[model samples]
Target: MILSTASSSQANAAFWRFLATRLLVSLLTLLAVSFMIYGLIELMPGDYAERELFRKYSGTGVTITQAEIDRVRADLGLDRPFLVRYGEWLWNVVTRLDFGPAFRVETSVNALIGDKFFYTFVLVVGAMLISYIVAIPVGIWVASRKSGIGDGVVTLLSYLGLALPNFAIALVLLMLNAFVFDLDVTGLVSQEFRDAPWSMAKFLDFLGHAYIPLLVLGWSTTAFQLQTMRGLMKDEMGKLYVTAAQARGFSGWPMLIKYPARHAVMPIVSTIGFDFSRSFNELPIVASILVLGELGQELLLAFLDADQNTAAGILVCITSVIIAANFLSDLLVAALDPRVRMRGGR
Candidate 1:
């Protein structure tokens, strides 16, 4: 009894330590990424002041003078040294949660991003859920039917999904919608609910339009995961433990689920963060094509306008989501597999 209690206590302590270490690493990574994003934006050719001034005077035959540019820079505090500005920005972000202002729109970065990131998060996460839901069963089924026609067909479809670009799929769907369905396929909401208050109708309208982007984003992810799960399941099935389980008369679903499936799923659970990051990497172009009012679109516009504050804010938020997802994945993996916790403890 005493030994059992001691082992349990050790496990609890190890879990807490693992959590703390992951938190520390995530924070440090987020800080470094934020600094790099800010520095890259700073290195861009023109500042917001320059872009605004040039846009204002261009095609009017009025040349923008150095004096005018300098005046605008001074007013916007853009003349400060890079390190000094970055330090202040970092401090403000850390202490006050102030992401500063959107240079072009003259609005707080926080205010400008209101609800936009939420929409993006909902779309990305929804796609991820769909991918996992579809991939797992199909992957298991294909792996079970290895070398059969069903496996060949699924393998072909998975390859096609991975090879075809997401934008191409979106374009094909758009063409089909235009020519055949005549349904509204763009944006997160229909015209009636675009500005409507949050109600069941508006939310249903959102889901109605959301499925296109979800399908587009989830297509490749589902294929990749299906291939991964199938490979992992096949590998696990050939292992000694699976053979031993079969000898014990554990067959079919029970045998697969009890012996191989549990082990095969560990890698998948551990890779949730990477999957989220991959989905986000494809979001900007997809969002633009679909005319979705999400932070991905805002991020592109901010960079084009040289609005560093807005761009940095959006990038940092996206990075935070990825980091948070990674942290959660680590926790889940550690919980499901005691080996992971033991390694962390060591």
Candidate 2:
């Protein structure tokens, strides 16, 4: 045993030690990510204030002089030193949970992202669940059947799914809905429920419109997971331990799952980390095609409009989620695999 005792005391201590290390590392990573995002936005040419001024006055009635633009820039804190601005932003976030006000929209970054975060969460989470549900059995079936027609069909579909971009999938679904189904598949909510207050009707309406995006996002993820699971299962089944078990009359699903499948599934668990990040990163293109006004779409617009505060906050939020997902996956792997636990996450 890695611990001094074979008792609960040793197990509990090891778990706590692992958790504490994960938390500390997560915090440090978050800080580094925030700094990088802020610094990169600062490096972008021109200030938001200048952009706003040009937008307000360019080709419009008023003429913005250089002096006036400079004054506006100062007012918007663009005149502040890079280090000073970054320090203030970081301090505000740590102390007050403030992400500052977004230019053009004139709302706090929190409010802008808060309004849309749930929908993004819903889309991503729903897709992830669907992917796992479809992938697991399909992967196992393909692995077990190996060289059979069912395996061939799954391989073909997986390859196709991986080849197609998400937006292409969304576009195809939209075309299908238009020509055949007549289902409401365009946006995140129906027109009536869009501006309406929260109600059961609105909630149901949201689900009704969510199906297509969910399918598009889930399909690619399912394909990737299926490929991964199939490969891992095949490799584990070929190992000496599995061959030894088979020689002892262990066979069929029980033996497969009891021994090899457990090890095979580790990669899938670790993949949960990248899967979340992939879903978030893929959202912008998919959301744009579907006209879903979630955090992904909003963040894309923020970048286009040079809305630095909103953009920064959204980036930070997404990065934090990715980091948290990875941390959770680490914990799950340690818990599931005794080898990993013994190694203390290496």
lDDT of each: 0.87, 0.83
Residues 158-220 of candidate 2: C-alpha lDDT, one tens digit per residue? 999999999898999898998897775878888877777888988988988888889999999
Q: Which stretches of candidate 1 lie over 4 Å from their true place?
A: 1-8, 146-149
TM-score of each: 0.92, 0.90
Error of 2 at 182 (Å): 2.3
Give the clashing pairs for model 1: none
lDDT for predicted candidate 1 compared with the true structure:
0.87
lDDT of 1 by residue, 23-45 (tens): 99888987887788778878899
